[model samples]
Target: MLSRTADHLFWMSRYMERAENLARLMDVTYQMSLVPQSEEKANQSWNAIITLNSLEDAFAAKYPVVNGENVLKFMVCDSDNFSSIYSCLRLARENAHAVRGTLTTEMWETINYTWLEARGRSFDQLMAGGIADYFEWVKTRSHLSRGVTVGTLLQDEAYHFIRLGTLLERADNTARILDVKYHGLDHGGEEGATDFYQWGALLRSVSAFEVYRKAYRDVITPERVAELLILRGDMPRSLLFCMNGVVKNLDLVANSLSGETARLAGLLRAQLRYGRIDDILEHGLHEWLTDFMDRIYLIGDGISRDFLVPMVEAA
Candidate 1:
């Protein structure tokens, strides 16, 4: 396959995964808002969602009102915001559309339907009925698309590229969610057992709540949360899990460890495997996560260099 084709397939899946995660994050925040928290706490929830997406300025310009309703509208329906759900699904479909022949019919149909559904709705239309149901629908569709991509696509270069993209995006989002939890806690004071609820909510935001509960048997400490998200190799969305998947895909693409792709993946995977959770906590969790994210970003660049972009001279 051409490097360009690989790049597109990888990015197509990445964008779709990103849209789903953002939708899930916003959904959790919106649901929490409906509970009886102080006005200040509710606003913080909205603010955190905006911050997580790194869309403060765009969000500010459109939703100067900045309440739960307006924030949801701006994030979910507004196409002007580049990371909005509508924009992401549209971009995902467009990328897939360009390579229709390379993908299965189900892959194209899943993403195309997602694009249509998102494009056809107005913010008011969503807000009028069940808000949670709407966000859940978006997430469900995104999940379905990913399932179709994995189940239907052949295990060739196309599938590897898409898998790489999805894993990379998941790694970054997992890192960001960890950082957000630490920051939110440091700034927002503890509310007794409410911290447990909040911590559980954080897990729920990443859809890790049930996994976590099963693993620890109702024990939800901050440290355990950090470990589960960052160090657990079995959890699909964990950083370790993502890194492992990415390395496997990178190896499959480049076909050998001599290339830059192999070297980059090996380096990052080694770091994840060797690093201890206690060490991360002893030194500093936030700084550790920040460094980990930076390395992942570097790995992404390296992958693009070796696989997505040609290394040959421009004759």
Candidate 2:
């Protein structure tokens, strides 16, 4: 396959997955904001979203405050914010269009229609219509797009690249959400009602709340939640699950030049596979997750260098 086609397919899926994850993040943060708390605590919750995406500078430039209203507008529809849901859907559609012939009709229509609907709604309209509803709409549209792609698109190299993009993006976002929220919450001391609610919100953010209950059949705790999201292979959105998918897809699409990239992905997967949550917490979850994110970035760079567009070294 041409590297150009591969690039577009890879990013189209990535952007779509990113948009859905952003909706999940915003929804959870929005829910947490509704909980009764001090003004400072509420502000901290909203600000955590900004920090999670590393959008502190960009968010500050446009919005004077870090409250719910401003952050929602900035994250949901700010055209200049490349990571905003609006921008993600737009970019996904554009990439899909670039390789229009490569995509199935169902796939193209699903993405194009998602962009069309999303582009028509402004932040004000989203707020007026109920932001939670809009967030659900975004998540539903993303699910539809993925379902269509999986059902309609042939399972070939193109399919492998799309799946790769989704898995890698999911892995990065899962780590980001877990690391940021874990630190932001009061986990250094004893667990309380507030901590329980915060931890439950975090689980629901990744649709892991029920899984947590089933796996432990007990009250939510920092350690069990961490284990569920980080180590449980059965948890669909778990880091381990995402890495497993990444390794499988990389193997399917591997070329002679992609051996190193595949090896890097496998190395990460092996670490997660053999990893224990107790050791991760002992070493410091933040430190461990920081290392994981850095490695994820390296794998992304490797993918670009090996399969997509090769990055040129600075002169």
Candidate 3:
């Protein structure tokens, strides 16, 4: 495959996955904002989303405050924010269009229609229609796109690249979400109602609440939630699960020049596979997640160097 085509295929799926995850983050943050809390605590919840995406500077430049209204507008519909849902969907469609011939009819149509619907949504329009409902629509559209791709596309290099992009993006977002929420909560001696609600909200954001219940058959705790999301291979959105998929897909699409990228992915997967929640917490979850994100960045850079267009050419 041409490097340009590979690049488009890879980022096309990544942007789509990113849009879905952003919706998840915003939806949960929105829900948390509705919970009764001090004004400062509510703002902190909203600000956590900004911090999770490392958009502090960008967010501050455009919005004077970090409250729900401003944050929602910035995250959901701001055209200038590259990582906003609107921008992600637009870029996903643009990339899909670049490689339209390589995609199945269903996949192209799914992506194109999603963009068409989401193209010009204003914050007021989104709020009028119901914020949570709009987010649910984004998630549903992403799910449909993935479902169609899996069902219609051939299981070839193109498919593997798409899967790789999705898994890597998912893993990165999962780690960020967990790290931000875990640290944001009060870690004092006992769990309170607020902590329980916040933790439960975090689980629901990742679609892991029910999985947590089934696996532990007990009340939600920081340790069990961490264990479920980080170590449980069966949890589809778990870090381990995402890394397992990443390693598998990287293997499928591996070339002679891609050995190092594959090795990085494999190493990360092995660590998660053999990892324990106790050790991760002992070492400090924030520090551990920081390292994980750094490694993920390296693996992404390796993938680009090995298989995708070079930085200069892409520029």
Winner by TM-score: 3
- Cα lDDT tens digits, model 2, 131-204, are 99998898899999999999999999999999999999999888888876776654553257877887898898
Q: Model 1: per-residue lDDT, tens digit, 1-315? A: 987788778778988988888777777677566666688777876877677667888887776666787788777878898788888888888889988899999989888988887888888788888777887887799789888877887898889999989999889878877776686676545766667777877798788999998898967889899989888899888988999998888777775433775777778788778888888888888788778878878887777777775435311
Model 3 worst lDDT run, 10 consecutive residues = 182-191
Ranking by TM-score: 3, 2, 1
The TM-score that candidate 1 achieves is 0.90
Q: For model 3, how many clashes?
A: 0
Task: List candidate 1 stretches off by more than 4 Å.
Answer: 255-258, 309-315
Put down candidate 3 lDDT per residue, 117-197, tens digits, no spaces: 998677888899899999999999999999999999999899989998999999888888787676565355225897788
Q: What is the C-alpha lDDT of each candidate?
A: 0.80, 0.89, 0.89
- Best candidate (score: lDDT): 3
* Candidate 1 structure lDDT: 0.80
Better of 2 and 3 by lDDT: 3
Listed in order, each prediction's TM-score against the native is: 0.90, 0.95, 0.97
